[model samples]
Target: MSIQCPSCNSQRIITRDIARKLGGTTGAIAGGASGMAGAAGGARVGTLVGTIGGPLGMTLGGLAGAIIGGLVGSAAGGAAGAKLGEEIDNKVLDNFQCANCGHCFRQQD
Candidate 1:
């Protein structure tokens, strides 16, 4: 769909997803912080399992577990955050700008 400026009728428009960007970043950080606990648990389990294969296996297993846990948390958080941000953009923020006239407006439903 083409978005035109309500004030100027200009078709040149830009999107400013301020909330989305901020939300995603904040959520990722929060999720990663929380993921630390998950990582610790994963590491413990990995270490226990790895012990059967000796020292190298234990080290690799722990590292892999921690990394996976952190990544999963970060990804989940980012997705959730982005969705929330999108809602804010649509309903609360003036998310569109007319490039030709520099007028900011909310998307019209």
Candidate 2:
């Protein structure tokens, strides 16, 4: 069930690390932005929730909100980043040339 190079039928295929790096970097950026947005929304909600507890309650609520928001955001970001990385590997990185034959081809899934 191993991937064979189409041109030379060689199994010495190597994955390109750069594709994962690029995909992960892009994913991190996207995740960070979404996380920030989540934090802002959470803070607003927390503020309202804390209203019942007074100023002290408000502070606690905001802190809790921020923590929860950050966790959720980070989880979502990581998942998205991993998916993007896989896509990059599949679509782009899989097209590496075989060292033995110097033939460029996509890896068989």
Candidate 3:
């Protein structure tokens, strides 16, 4: 029941920590960028809403906008990150060789 090398049917499989690390880093960057973009857009909309309520209304509207923006951005970024992580895992990290057959192939999940 252990993981087997698809090509060589070998059990001597190695894990790649670097690939995971790189994937996480990539995800974080994307998330941060999206969050910032969302905040900017939210702020602009909030400002318009606040004009009707005056200073206090503006402050609340902006705060609300930022929160909403951040949440939406985070979700979108997280999804993008997961997709990227999978691609990295399949294309880069999954590259392994079977000691018995010497077959080079991607690891199956």
Candidate 4:
């Protein structure tokens, strides 16, 4: 499937393939960022839980929670970021115009 930019008509469209690639790259970055954030959050939670639950609880629960939270956060962030990135790429493709013919071209894979 292809996306057409209404402002530019059919002149500028973003191909699904290119958009996917852009999304992949964007998702990777976002995933890493999210993972880091999740890990930090998990650590904080672990600390809190440790204090409340004592040493044994902290050792088991904190470790498990951190791993699980980090993985889940990374996946969600990656997917969300990929979608947003694809949209932005589409917008950029839509606005670009050819200097010679004033024709906008859709991004190609």
The lDDT of each candidate is 0.88, 0.74, 0.72, 0.64
lDDT of 1 by residue, 60-90 (tens): 8898788888888888888888889988998
Indicate the TM-score of model 1. Answer: 0.94
Clashing residue pairs for model 4: 11-104, 13-106
Q: Report the Cα lDDT for candidate 3.
A: 0.72
Instruction: Tell me how candidate 1 scores on lDDT.
Output: 0.88
Off by more than 4 A, model 3:
5-21, 95-105
Each candidate's clash count: 0, 0, 0, 2
Q: Write the per-residue lDDT of candidate 3 for residues 19-97, one digit (tens) a residue.
A: 4556666666677678878888898799789879999998888888887888777666666776677677677765566
lDDT of 4 by residue, 1-109 (tens): 5544444455343244455566766776677677777877886787677877788877766777677667777677667767776677566654345443466554555
Compare the candidates by TM-score and give the number of the best one. Answer: 1
TM-score of 4: 0.50
Which stretches of candidate 1 lie above 4 Å from their native place? none
Of the candidates numbered 1 and 3, which has the greater lDDT value? 1
Cα distance off (Å), candidate 1, residue 52: 1.9
Error at 105, model 3, angstroms: 7.5
Residue range with the least summed lDDT across 10 consecutive positions in model 4: 8-17
